[model samples]
Target: MASNRPAPQGVYVPNDDDFGGYDDDSSWEEWNPTEESIRPVRGRHRVHKRGGGGLARSSTVLGVGVIAAVGAGGMATAQGGKPPVAIEMPDVSAVTDSLPEAKSLPGVGALISDGSDDSAAAGQNVAVAAAPLSAAGVSTTDAEQGTTDAGEALRARIMEQAENQQDQADDAVQKAAEEAAVKEAAAQAAAKQTAAEKKIAAEKAAAKKKAEAERLAKLAKSYTLPVASYTLTGTFGQPGSMWSSGYHTGLDFAAPTGTPIKAVHSGTIKEAGWAGAYGYRTVLELDDGTEVWFCHQSSMNVSAGQKVTTGETIGRVGATGNVTGAHLHMEVHPGGDATGVDPAAWLRGKGQSL
Candidate 1:
């Protein structure tokens, strides 16, 4: 007999337990959702039975409660200050269509395609990831090349500067050397000019001295000594008692009584007569108006108006009136005056020693 019963709202209904018991020998198998027989319909809910029986309705209720508890835990986790992220699942059908067919190997079971092409693709990806990027979004190789070029340019600039400096230094040194050479040349020229002037002056001085010597030689040829073969007896300006004056007024030449006297230079006879204290005295007047008096002469050979050349005999030496030995007294007067100069010095002016 069947009895009518009212079930509670949330309670589970159980069927009769026909199997021996839920034992440890039970076997479990994985469910294949891809199989056409087990495929679930869209927008419909259904429960499939396990082999030999269905799970107890209490067990199903307990599984639903567990799923509900897990859903509540996930909601709590979402509310605990973490934001929820949406993930998209890939289409398996599209992935399978793109892959190559599976192949069987000798030792291995069915295997997917060999990964040589995939590895090459992966290598390209790795290369892209490993490369460094610059701030301008360029590759590291290009950046390094740019750095090398810049370095080379900088080095070239430095070398150019050094070469320019060297050239400048060389120019300065060359300029200094040229300046020094110019100064040296100028100095040498000046020295040569000075030497030339000195040579010219020396030549002029020598010529003038030679001309004067020739003129003096010609003049000396026209002059002669007053008397020859005579001994010096008295000198002028000697303090003695033999003269009216306090000093000797003339030179005295001692010789033989008849020694000949000569004219000292070219002159005209002015006085040829005797005077007091001077026997046979003769006077000669030169061209320049100077007079020569020969005193104490033995005789006179020239008259008052006769001209006599140098060395011509004019008188003879004798102590006629004066109280001296055989000697001749000579006196010289400028312009035929009483005042006289030393005859020895006058004769020496005409290049005569005495």
Candidate 2:
């Protein structure tokens, strides 16, 4: 006859002390054996009590254990008592859907579920999960690229500033050169103006000199000497015993008794007669009220009130009164006064020699 109770679903037994070291409080759940169950047919196995609450707790612990094993496999090393291992994760979206989404954890990325059927997207998620291992390398590459970009920008700014400064310097130099050129042009203009002024002054001086020379030439043509052929016997203001005055008052020309005397300038004869010691004196009155007296004359050729030109015969030389020898005495009276000036100097003033 068949037994009334159902047979055990699955079993696990340890050959050594590996499974016997669990604490008394530790609990396990029963698993049903199927074709996929990893159990040996001929080993000694043990059965544990099954409970609904314990089944949920055992499933959670088993999922955590599987994740930890996969993470450790990625970091495995072939050294000392361990061997190297490579971990390849399978798609687990179906399994993750049955559980609540895990909250964020420190030192681990968030557990986000992707329910899409695209194989390429699932592969990308796997690639992202592997990123934590290469985080250092990726960050180093980004930092170097940032540094290079910053250096290039700084160099460009410095070059722009240098070009601006060069432009300013060039402008200053050009302005200074323009100012210098203006100053030099002004100096040249001033020098030319000064030279023109000097030239004008020199021309005026030459003109004045030319006018003075012409005036002198015309005056010489209008005046003449008193007696042409005569010897200078006495000068005016000579002290002499023969003169009636204590000093000689006129110029004396010693000549032969009949020497001719001419009018000294163009004038009218004022008087022609004896005047005491001035003996047969003749007086000539000029247009400007000056008088010329010729004394000690042997004879008078011009009468009173006769107009005569310069160098015309007016009298003859003689020793008629108070004379040391035969000579003509001549006196010049400005404005026709009795007191006279030197006749020699008066004749010289008219461009004539004594």
Candidate 3:
């Protein structure tokens, strides 16, 4: 089958010097006879008998043809003493077209050129045919397989790159999620701390308020009303023609004629048995330099500068000291001033309701 393929064309030139033999019939010789005459000479070449068996004289041209065929494809090969492996034939024209011009082939191109336009066709047919054999190392089978491997390699690289990118994306998302969770945990801790601080502050404020209330209750116990079992007949600042002042300056407590009047709080009795419009008045001065005036009393029991305890009976209630009815008119002077404040409001400051 390899022989059925055409030999590579124009690869070598014919020359008389290539074949060493006589061409004319005059150089022919007659036959041999004895075995000693046919024995091979020791120091000389073993000359083989040549006849019409093959083109033995054209062996040089035929060797060039085999080399060309090897270059052009379809050269069978033997491996490991096995039968010769059949080689696939490629298009000789395709292989030749890829090679350099016959003029470029080593040693063959110059011999093919005879310096005449008539030999141009032979020059064109000869070529640098060895390019396919040496550069490619094999026929189209290896080349086709190489192309397929290159494609698969490129695809594998693309897939690897895609997988790497996906891994990167997943890592980024996980990092973001972890950071968000940390932030959320920090925010929750801050909120709980704030709530605890607020609760502590509220508790402190409530405790302070309860302690103040207890102090005020104890202080209220230290005070007492000047007279009990009495009715409030007139309030402070009552406008009427009942006294010297145009407006009433004290509170009036209406009681029976012989009702006992008491000291409002622990204080020194400043003055008693007052004259003029105050008929039987008693003045009590407290520790804070505030004076309490109990007016319109029937009689007095304490004198000036006498220390008296709170709620002590000082005098009896009667119609005295510019009084319209039997009542006790009480007035208060803070820091011992002549102008008095409302006695009802002053008692209320001691936690007493009028």
Candidate 4:
């Protein structure tokens, strides 16, 4: 196709700057387009998803349209000298092909190389040019989104890392608290168990002591005092020299003469005869072979070999022989031994008190 713009019947010619900086006006005389001008791009450029997928046809159409528009603008500048309309190409979607070839108006072979002939290096160059912004370490997504803020991605990463660290620290503290709670519970359980065991032991000891006391109380029933209504004048082991022995070997119960004397415990009459200093002495032998002597008696109520019970009348208090006043003397001999022991203490052992 041919486009002719003849100057309006005037003898004026267009300037060189209006026709791709050509100094000779003859060079801009007439121009026509050829099929060779439409260069067939060998490789395809990948556009962003938001952009349409027709890279070859679109890019070809776009390049040809830009040259046509610039050519018209040059014509305007040469003819009327009006300020060339502002020719700014808005930002386009991302590309992944070699760089866009530098283009000028058609028929202006003086400016750019003839890329109508393609090669591997040129193709690589185009691919580099068409490569996404991400290939140059820029965020293609953000760039495509028209993001203007810098360091936003870096700030997001730092915040994410800090949050992770805080979460880990919280988990560690919670675990430690749980462990501490478990340990405290175990300690409390141990203390409770120890207290329960101690209480059980104390209860057992108390029961045992009560049982022993009950046993002792039962044993005191069988024993009685030798003579009631009599005053205790001399205890066993007294140091009075009024008797033949150096110390008093008997417990003296002072009483009026003829007062009744009772048997101390259930026993048989072993001896009911007199000793010279002992007055009318009576000896009783128990089933356990212990002997109790009752002396200074005015009269005996039972004969030898006779059985008697506790508290039964056996004799009368008297100072019949070698005595100054009426009284009764008592002695105890265990297992029929000739020597006697402290009757008061022995009675206490059997749960009896003086």
Candidate 5:
């Protein structure tokens, strides 16, 4: 027995195994239309019928019209017949009115190449014109490295020079300080020496003044003697057997040998020598025409006619006479006269006690 039924609308039908479904609804799963359900296309997709059956025939005609219109719109967009490319406006700031002409860019010939072997030669020429970018033909990377090395060397030189200059300045300062110190020391030493010399001169002056004052004082109180003490031991004409000048011409003194005899006055020694029986006698003459005789000395100290200062030693006392004991005989002569004043009285008149 065979059962027959009407197929469902939009149902799939088999074509072959490769084209498994005739309706292909699986390929259009999102949206699908059947000839029974689809409406005729129109407007942007519209078409007019020449001659057709009914709605099916009209739907196919409308679909053809819609497809033709969409194809025409797409073709126009792809054609070069569209609006010209819009020109870009120029920026005023980028204008070159203020700048000089720029040099040609290197490798620019390559960009304008006509695909010939000569293009390489033109590019090389542009590169030669751009050689000023580097100091030598070497690349910038190598040049920059050399420049860095040179900069470091220059920095080292500058530092060395600075150090040398600093050393010189320090040496000059030290020398100046040393010279100043030496000068100051010399000045101080000179000042001290001058002060010491002044002090010594002042001391010498004071000593000289003191000596002069003492000399003047001695002169004011000075006196003269009439007879030396060594010459007279006894009075005028005393009785004694030790008479040297015949019965003691003057007087005798018994003194030790070598006792000093002094001048009686500031006079001259008139005679000084040995006398008969009055050995080693000395005579001193005065400005008043008076003469004093001393006898019996051990030695005479002054020469005859020599100037004798007052109280100066003329001889030594002794007993060198025609006598028994050592003694001196003294005599005074007024103008060499045999008759003379008493030696004792003459000593008193001259402010001396015999």
Candidate 6:
């Protein structure tokens, strides 16, 4: 008779020894399925009640073996022994990896679903170490900003000081220029004043010299003799002079018997008289109290208290006194004293040469 049955999906088949039912001598060796150990044959087979039961048991044992192998694979992955050692985690933007708002934490947390290797654990540890470094970088940047601000302030101060110094220098220069101009003006004025003074002094000296020369020429024109027609017979203080007083006291002039005698200067007639030694005599007094005496005259024409001008004829010359011949004696008395000076020297004082 023909038979029909379904084929198994895997090649594993269980034996009775799988249930621990065989004696020691009939014990089955353990089956480890490999690629070459089991294969399916193309044949129709009959199902027996006892054989179906063995097949069912075989399927159960195979199912149990597959379960144990998958459990061991899971355990090996957990213990950090898989080929994919580094497991990927979520970034900081993910909900599970977001940074906390707490001040105690400083960095983002990583979201790890399968952290099954040594490298994954090392990456998480690196994230923890970065927190303190980020905080230190913030402090360093703030210090650098402060230093930049200080440098700007220092530069501003230096510029202000330079401007002030320039202003002071300009002011000093202006003041010095003004002072120099004032000094120059003063010096020019002083020189002009000195020059004017010198000119005035020169003019005064020239005028004084001219006045003195004119004064000297006016004194030479004022003298006349006692008699117009006469000859000098005796001089003043002659060594061999003879007279009534043992010395000749006056000058003698020889002339004709009626020659008119005149006054030599302006004076007043004090006397007209006759004397013992001097025959018809006359005396004339001047303004400064000087007196002039004319003796041995032929006759007198002037009387007392009669004023006479210079060169006025007072009497005629004649031989009427104690004399050797016809002549006139002329005598000068300063302040009416008896003695007299040399008449030649006195005539020269009026710019006349004797």
Clashes found in each candidate (C-alpha, N, C closer than 3 A): 0, 0, 3, 11, 3, 0
lDDT of each: 0.74, 0.76, 0.76, 0.75, 0.65, 0.69
Which candidate wins on TM-score?
Answer: 3
lDDT string, candidate 6, 138-243, tens digits: 3344455553344454555577789989999998998899899899888988898888888888877777756644553464444566776667888777765356
True lDDT of residue 136, candidate 4: 46
Ranking by TM-score: 3, 4, 1, 2, 6, 5
Tens digit per residue, CA lDDT, model 4, 98-196: 445445444333334456666765666566565554434336665576543446645555787999999999999999999999999999999999999
Compared with the true structure, the alpha-carbon lDDT of candidate 5 equals: 0.65
lDDT of 5 by residue, 1-354 (tens): 222223344534444343222222232123354564344454565445445556777799877765675566532121323322222468777777755434345555433434457866668755665545334444455456564344454555578799999999999999999999999999999999999989988888888877755654454234344233444557776665655443445655666777677777778888988887777789888888789998888888889889987788788877776656777667788897876567766665565544
lDDT of 1 by residue, 51-95 (tens): 634557768887777567556654222223433333356899999
Clashing pairs in 6: none
TM-score of predicted structure 3: 0.46
lDDT of 2 by residue, 1-354 (tens): 322234454444433334233223323456666553433344344323455766888899977875676586564432233433445567799777876535354433323435779878677666666544433333344455553344454555578789999999999999999999999999999999999898888888888767755665566688887777888988999997876687889998888999999888899999999898888999999999999999999999989999999889998999987787899999999998889999888876676755
Worst 10 residues of 1 by lDDT: 14-23
Candidate 2 lDDT score at position 351: 66
Better of 2 and 3 by TM-score: 3
Tell me which of candidates 1 and 5 scores higher on lDDT: 1
Task: Note the residue pairs that clash in candidate 1.
Answer: none
lDDT of 3 by residue, 115-177 (tens): 566555555544433233333334355455563344455565578799999999999999999
Which residue pairs in candidate 5 collide? Answer: 45-66, 319-326, 319-327
TM-scores, in order shown? Answer: 0.43, 0.42, 0.46, 0.43, 0.34, 0.38
Name the better of 2 and 5 by TM-score. 2
> Residue 191: error of model 5 in Å?
86
